[model samples]
Target chain A: MQKRNTEITVGMFVAAGIVAIFVLAMKVSNFTDFTDDAGYEVVAEFGNIGGLKVRSPVTMAGVRVGRVSNISLDGSTYNAKVTLSLYSQFNTLPTDTSASIFTAGLLGEQYIALEAGAEEEFLKNGDVLHLTQPALVLEQVIGQFLFSKAEGE
Target chain B: MIDFIRSLGRWGLDTLQRLGSGHLFLWYMVKGIPEVLLRFSLVIQQLQSVGVRSVMIILVSGLFVGMVLGLQGYNTLVDFGAEESLGVLVSLSLVRELGPVVSALLFAGRAGSALTAEIGLMKSTEQLSGMEMMAVDPIRRIIAPRFVAGIISMPLLAAIFSAVGIFGGFIVGYGLLGVDDGAFWSQMQVKTDWYDDVLNGVIKSIVFGVVVTWIALFEGYDASPTSEGVGRATTRTVVHSAFAILGLDFVLTALMFGEI
Candidate 1:
């Protein structure tokens, strides 16, 4: 009886350990929203990524509608091609919908934010989003600020 | 006054030269390596007896540590309006620094002192001498098991500590602290590098195990075979091992962070 009790306790501890590891892995992997949201694929190109990585959210008007699926660079153009999986239910994105790389907050993570365009035609799977803004380089912004300040002086 | 100043300066130079040779320490380390490894294996067996048997205490302590980290981190970050970053803060701090160090310290306090005292008592009773008459190597027979146990128990305890702590943090942070589960995890996913934190923790545990076990064994082996000697050895094992752990932590941190 004592042996059986000890075995049960050991089993319980092992089970708890396994559960904790699973929880940690799930948390670290961002395994939320595993249920497929209705979505279609669209592509955008940018000159610089600025720590923007795959699996980053694609937000429309501050609401996450999709996520970055893949990031690759065009061999000849030297442009980064970012593939976004947008929810199919939100088909309001026009053909001219523009994408911009923006930070969530000051010193926060970067995400691809979409600005819906006024055009009537909706974007389709495999559609290339032509109206795109690249990441704002911090050095460029600081340099511009300094240069403008110097000119004002 | 001139002679005093000159002597003080000479003493300082000699101290610097001794510190610079550091090879003397390295030689001692080399000489100890084989004995350490043998003792390490024996310590592993002892862990089966001591640590694996003490699962309840380790579990409860680990959970509490995790819960505290989460609750405290949440409150602090919320004050700054960065509540969502609780996951990153908890996971990084636990896995990188707190988990292994805290668990090892606890293990040393519990099992380390016990090992030292047990060996010290055996020495005082002349059981160690009896083993020597039987041609049994006391270092391998007596000291090795505790040393091996210490090394094994530390990593296992560290792993449990991290796992429980993360879970506890999650429970408190997400359940009570009002941080959204999704936001918490997303922040963690973005900030954490598994190789950097988890692997670093394991490496630290290995080094900690070595240091704690070695100190315990060394003290026991050198015990004066008297009651007073046993008491002194036990105290030294705990005190010296604690200092060694702190010093090695600094060295490892510097090396891991590329300060070396």
Candidate 2:
């Protein structure tokens, strides 16, 4: 009985180690977020999304309040339709809040940053954020810079 | 010129002889596997010696490796103004490469050398011969359990090493360096792939486990039954296991990454 107990314990330890590795791998690689957080949804339209991806964090005043749930293209307008899943508590965002896709740091990741404005009306589900800004494409900026430099030279 | 040619010829012959002996020794080890199922207690005892005891060293080294990566990754990423990616950098390095390679090297140094010395000492004492006289196969009763334990322990140890190392990286990246905690985690969580980084690491460590254990046991079994011979075998186990691990890692990595 004692010997069997020892073996069982050892087996458990190994099993525990394997589980830890799985969690660490997922956590490090960002495969699954534990909190599949429940939240409300809103829509925004952009002329260009650049390289923004689904699940990209939506921030307000530099704090993450939601994530990009889905991104698609409108057939007529050629605009990108992005769905934002904001946390339930952050549903108090005013209807006049401006949404923009901004790059972090100099060349870091891109995210949807929201700048709130004064409005008595609060945003609700299915509401569209009217004021939207598009991402600044680096290639275009570099191209313009080279063109200006060539003209100056 | 003739002398140089003759010495080179002799070295080649010597290597062939060692390789032949190692192969035969592995055969003997494998022949004992059926007995392991009946002698489960032996496997457990060996597991305790090989796995449970080595946890401390593996954890400490893993922690240090992570800390070094976190600190260095921060410095480099800061130049690009992207320090927030530290979590991804540290975890990816540890899981994909450093975790398996470094842990195997440490295993060879600590457990591999010890197994060789213990088995060599047992042979010198004539216990193996004594067991044979009593109608017991020492390979089945003695060596197989240790072999099984080693193969089982190594991958788990590597896993533990990688897991703890990430936390060490976390402390250095978020706690000390002031990288945004949210960005540190969310960026890493979103970017890391389960199959490419994590599974590959586990596979690499499993291969390492087999190689290190095989060399250690074979060296011990083939050791001359004397104190000096036992010491030499122990030393050879460490050196050969380390070399085999590095060589195998290169081949395995190439096979995994190369498209052709």
Candidate 3:
């Protein structure tokens, strides 16, 4: 009887551990920077998204200050419309702040990296940033390098 | 020259005879299908006994596999300055291939051979013949239960393996390895697709279960009606099941990924 009880308890513990791990995994995957009512929104338009998935970090000079909220298409222009949720404390983004999809390292995931521009005017919420660059596809870069090498040869 | 020709003829005859016998054995399996199905219900109960009860081992193994993958993957990626992509490698490798194949192989070794040996022993003792004489279909009674049990056990075991493995990775990578907790979580959420890897693992296990049970039951039923035959059958069941699993894994992977 004691053995049976011990077995059951062990099974329960394992089950609990599995559940906890799964919950933790879910929580980690959906990580966000927005604090309670303390974040602003901005919009950026891109020609191509490449592998820019939603919830990808929006970093400014290597510091993550926001995240991608939504990705849609402009019906008339056929451009990729990206909505970004910036932290409320980081409201001093210049009007000419350029948003570009950049990679961390070779063979790393793509992120929306923001480079602050030297402008006097501060950008407001929902204001669309002018300068934007799409993700640099590896294939294209490789192809260009190979083509240039061949031409030089 | 005459002696050499005679030896060659004899070898050809032997090969033909062996091939014919193998074909007849396959025919017997097909002909016994109705009986196999009727016996399958009872096999389901046996599988519950073997597969379901063995969940603890499967879970533990899965956890260990996941944890090791996490630790190793993180270390390798960190060296390359790409530690955050560990989720992609761990989840993809485990789900797409390792989870089902490893768990099924373990199940075959632990339970599959035992089932074959038990049934082979009963056959050697004429216990199966006694049932046949009493108008009882032995395939329905003995073979079906094991077959059903294997099919039921494999998928469940594979699922436990995948879940446990992922969790193990999390514990080792996050808790022990000290990967940025938030970064780890965010990477997994944004990158991992449960449907692609997890579902594929379960499906592969189901196919593996059927193949393992079929090979085991086939060897057990066809054993020579002797004590020695039971021992031979047990050995053959394990070896053949392992080979069949590996072959099927290759085939299934190719089919699933459209590699063909």
- Highest DockQ: which candidate? 2
Model 3 C-alpha lDDT per residue in residues A63-144, reported as the tens digit of each score: 9888888999999899999999888778899999999998866766678999999999988888999899988888998999
- List the global CA lDDT of all models: 0.76, 0.87, 0.75
Q: Order of candidates by TM-score, top first? A: 2, 1, 3
Q: TM-score of chain B, candidate 3? A: 0.83
The sequence of per-residue lDDT tens digits that candidate 1 reaches over residues B1-260 is 99999999999997687545433433454454477675554434465555666556677888898899998887788888999889889888887788778877776777777777887888889888999999986766666555555665676667778877877889999898778999887778766655556667778987898788777766766678888998898888888878888888888888885545
Ranked candidates, highest DockQ first: 2, 1, 3
TM-score of each: 0.65, 0.72, 0.64
Fnat per candidate, as a fraction, reads: 0.20, 0.68, 0.14
- Residue B51, model 1, lDDT: 65
Assess candidate 3 and give its TM-score to the true structure. Answer: 0.64
TM-score of 2: 0.72
**Candidates sorted on lDDT, descending:** 2, 1, 3
Of 2 and 3, the candidate ahead on TM-score is 2
Ten-residue region with minimum lDDT total, candidate 1 chain B:
B21-30
Instruction: Give the TM-score of chain A, superposed on the true chain A, for all candidates in the order listed.
Output: 0.80, 0.83, 0.77
DockQ of each: 0.20, 0.41, 0.12
Backbone clashes (count) for model 2: 3
